[model samples]
Target: MCQLLGLNCATPTDASFSFTGFCQRGGATDHHADGWGIAFFEGRGLRLFVDHQCAAESRMAEFLRSYPLKSRNIIAHVRKATIGDVRLENAHPFSRELWGRHWVFAHNGDLKDYQPRLHSQFQPVGTTDSERAFCWLMQELAKSHAGLPSVEELTLTLRELLPQVRRFGSINFLLSNGDALWAHCSTKLHYLVRQHPFTQATLMDQDWTVNFAELNQPGDRAAVIVTTPLTRNEQWTAFEPDELKVFVDGLPVEVA
Candidate 1:
C-alpha cells in the first residue's frame, strides 16, 4: 500500500510543515519507500514534482520541505510498489487535463484483477492499477458531462462510479480539480480541519512540532486528509468505509 496526503484551504497555504513529517514515512519512519510525488495547484497552473527515489532521501522532497509553495489545493503520494515497478512513471499524485482544468489523483490501496475498459480519450501512461483507475474515472466523467460539472454534480458521478472499482479491492484515494478536494475511503483514511484559535501539534512520524496559531490569522482555515493521522496530539476523524466526502474552503460540504 501507499500513503496519501491532501490539503484544501480557504486561501493559498504552504504544506511544508505537514510535508516535512510525511516525507519521513517514505523510508526513514515507515516503509513506503519506492517513490513519491506531489502536485500543487496555483490558479489553472500546476506545480508537479515526481521522483523514483525515496522521499526521505530525494533532494526534490527536501527542496519542497524548505520551499513554502502556497496553494489552495495539493495532493501527494508515497509509493510502496505493490503493482508496478519502481520508476518515475509509477510515481503518483498523477495529473491530467480535463475540461480546460488540471485534475490530480492519488491512491493508497491496491486493487486485484481490476481492469476497466477505457475506450475513450483518457488513458494511463503507467502500469499501476491506480493510474488505470484514474484514467477510467476521467473517461467516465467526460462521457457523463458535456463540460466540467459543478462540485456537487461531480461528487454524484463519482459516488455512482466508484462502487464498480471498489468491488475489486480497497480504493482509498484523493482527487482534486483546484476547486475542491474529494476523498474516498475503502479501507482506512482520516481527516481534520484547522481553523481559528489553532494550537500546537506534534508530528507522529518525526519529533517536530508547529504552533499554527503563531503564524496563521483568524480568517485562515485548512483541511488535511491523510491515510493516517499525521499529528499525535490533534484529534482526527476516521472516514467510514465506502464513504466519499468533498472539502471546499477547508470544510466538508454535503452533496446528495
Candidate 2:
C-alpha cells in the first residue's frame, strides 16, 4: 500500500513542514519506500514532480523541503510497490487534464484484479492498478458531464462511480482539481483543519515542533489529510469507512 497527503488552503501555503514528516515514511521512519511524487496547483497552472527514489533519500524531496513554493492545493504520495514496477512512471500523485483543468489523484490501497474499460484519451501509462483506476474514473467523469461540473455535482458522480470500483477492493484515494480536494476512506485516513488561534504542534516522525500561530496570519487556514495522523498534539478526525468528503478553503463542506 502507498501513503497519501493532501493540503487545501484558504490561501497559497507551502507544504514543507508537513512534507518533512511525510517523506520520512518513505524510507526512514516507515516502510513504504519504492518511490514518491508530489503535485502542486497554482491557480490554472500546475507543478508536478515524480521520481523513482525514496522520498527520504531523494535530493528532489529534500530540495522541496527547503524551498517554499506556495500552492492552494497540493497532493503527494509515497509508494510501496504492490502492483507496479519501481519506476518513475509508477510514481504518484498522477496528473491528467480534464476540462482545461489539471486533475491530480493518488491511491493508498491495492485493488485485486480490477480493470475497467478506458476510452477516449484516458489511458494508463504505468502498469499499476492505481493508474488504471484513475484513468477509468476520468473516463467516466468525462462521460457524465459535457464539461467540468460543480464540485457538488462532481461529488455526486464520484459517489456513484466509486462504489463500482470499491466492489473490487479498498479504494482509499485523494483527488483534486485546484478547486476542491476530495478524499475517500476505504480503510484508514485522518484529517485536521488548522485555522484561527493556531497552536504549536510536533511531528510524529521527527523531533520538530513549530508554533503555527507565529508563521500564519489570522486569516490563514489549511486542511491536512494523511493516511495516518502526522502530528502528536493536533486533534485529528478519522474518516469513516466508505466515507467521501470534500474540502474547500481548508474546511470540509457538506456535499450531497
User: Backbone clashes in each candidate structure, one number apiece?
Assistant: 0, 0
RMSD (Cα, Å) of candidate 1? 0.6
Scanning candidate 1 in windows of ten residues, the lowest lDDT window is 118-127
Model 1 misplacement above 4 A: none
Give candidates' CA RMSD values in order: 0.6, 0.6
- Model 2, 1-256: lDDT tens digits are 9899999999999999999999999999998899999999999899999999999999999999999999999999999999989999999989899999999999999899988888679999999999999999999999999998899999999999999999889988999999999999999999999998999999999999999999999999999999999999999999999999999999999985
lDDT of 2: 0.94
Cα TM-score of candidate 2: 0.99
Q: In model 2, where do residues sit more than 4 Å from their true spots?
A: none
Clashing pairs in 1: none
